[model samples]
Target: MIIILLILSVIIGVFLGKYFGKSQSFAKNLLILSAGFLITVCVSEVFPEVYEAEDHNIGIWIIGGVLLQMILESLTKGFEHGHFHHHHEEKNILPIALMAGMFVHAFLEGIPLANITDVTSPYLLGIVFHNLPISFILGTFLLREKNNIFSWFIITLFALASPLGMVFGDYFNPEWQPYFLALVGGIFLHISSVIIFESNKNHKMDWQKLFLVIAGVGLALVNHLFHAHH
Candidate 1:
């Protein structure tokens, strides 16, 4: 289901970008909210689970993941935080470096899902939903750069990255799940924090964006509660 949803998200994103022109404002708000959702899931679910191991001191690994994302952003140029710098009039060549960074992040995020107790889980939902806005971002970027077979090829590769990570992770040892979860938690922490903080210029807060962020956090909380009861 998770893999299916991820692929569907890519298709939906392509449709959206095709019918509608570039949606910068909508994409920005979506990015903000997506960041909020990710942070909430990391705090409310992932952190607690990874910290459960008695012998596992995952602090270093978490920090390492954070640093890794920082380096990735250097290559992606903050696309993970919805900072799409390219305009429609830019060159028609693909941004291989940026996509490479995003693929790495998406792939790593799927690792823990393969070993999760609840196959249908909030973490899975968080990742799927989080990818929603990202898919839009990718669609816009790719279509603008190369609206051809090459662009679809890149998009297909992006869609497959997480599912491929799940396949790899399923064969990985179960004992390592906690450490990988912590690493992913740290990666989420970094991405979400960047989206929230670096979004508005001059630190000016828009009330609508603020409300969206709040709504994102609220939705995650409700999802967590609902899952806990079930």
Candidate 2:
């Protein structure tokens, strides 16, 4: 059942991303929604439990993970921006580097899913929601570069990356789980924060955009609250 849900979520993410790619406004909205949802997931779902576990030096791992992503982004020259491929002309190394970093990040995220004792469904749902916008962003980039085959392959790989991580995580010792969780959480924070920050229109704040972010967070809160009460 869990495996099925994972596959379904990835499929949903791919299609939604493809659909949203056609509209800038809708894509922006989706990103904001994803941001809110990610923030909520981090705060309400991931943070509390991860902090409590305190199984490993999370702070350090988080910083390390963020640094890793920063380096990767620099190499990729902001491939996450979507629809912009001028950087692609610079070198082939950038795309390969970006994929490596993103793959590692996605796989680590899957590790936590395997660790989830309760609320597995909700967690997977949130992950799917989060990945959809990212998939769209990546897809847009691929389309712009006219690399259809590579784009599809990258998208498919992104979807499966997490599940693969979960498999690896399942074999890891319980004592080391906290460190992994913190690292993955940090990676998520970096990605989601970038999404929100980049999604901002101009340097000025937009109420509608802010609202979408809040809506995303609210969705996660609702799920968290339900879990808490239960």
Candidate 3:
């Protein structure tokens, strides 16, 4: 059921982009909102749980995840965020590196899901939220490229990557889940921080972006408080 939701989230995003991909600002706003929710979850939930569970140096894995994401971003060219479009316009060739990076990133995110207790897990919600804008942009990219065979193939793999990771995690050693969570937490941190702090063209802070970010954080906290008591 969770696996299906993950795939459906991507599918929904892709269709949304297909029909309404004109507004770059709106997409960025969504990204900001998602980032705010994501980082709050990480700081408020994931990091604390991992640290509480283990006394050893999980920071190593967290730092490793951050570096891994950096490498992946080099390949993805920031498509995981809002830096989409025109990347392949001139070449019109397949972006194998981008796909590879995206696939691995999504897959890693799902691996930790195998250990999560329920659908309400913040990690689960965070991925579902983050993947929407990503796949939406991918849909827009496909439209720009005329929606060829490669586009379908790309979409399929991207959609399946996280679910497959969850399956893989089901077989993975249970004890190691914390370390992997730490790793993913780091990846989330980097992605969200970059989105929130990366300035606009004039290098000035946009008040609207700031407000949406605050709203995202507030929503996450409210949800957290609600779940804590209920």
Candidate 3 off by > 4 Å: 90-94
lDDT of 1 by residue, 1-230 (tens): 77787678767866665555366888888878888888999999998888887546687888988999998888777767776656335543346876688789889988887886564487887787778777787788777546898678777888888888888999889999989888888998998888776646676877888898898899889889989998
Clashing residue pair totals per candidate (backbone < 3 A): 0, 4, 0
Predicted candidate 3 versus true structure: per-residue lDDT over 73-141, tens digit per residue: 888888887887566565542479878999999999999899876777767888998999898888887
Taking all chains together, the TM-score of candidate 1 against the true structure is 0.91
How far does residue 208 in candidate 2 sit from its true spot (Å)?
A: 0.9
How do these models rank on lDDT, best leading? 3, 1, 2
Query: TM-scores, in order shown?
Result: 0.91, 0.82, 0.94
Better of 1 and 2 by TM-score: 1
The lDDT for every candidate, in the order shown, is 0.80, 0.68, 0.86
Cand. 1 Cα-lDDT? 0.80
lDDT of the structure predicted as candidate 2: 0.68
Ten residues in a row with the worst lDDT in model 1?
A: 85-94
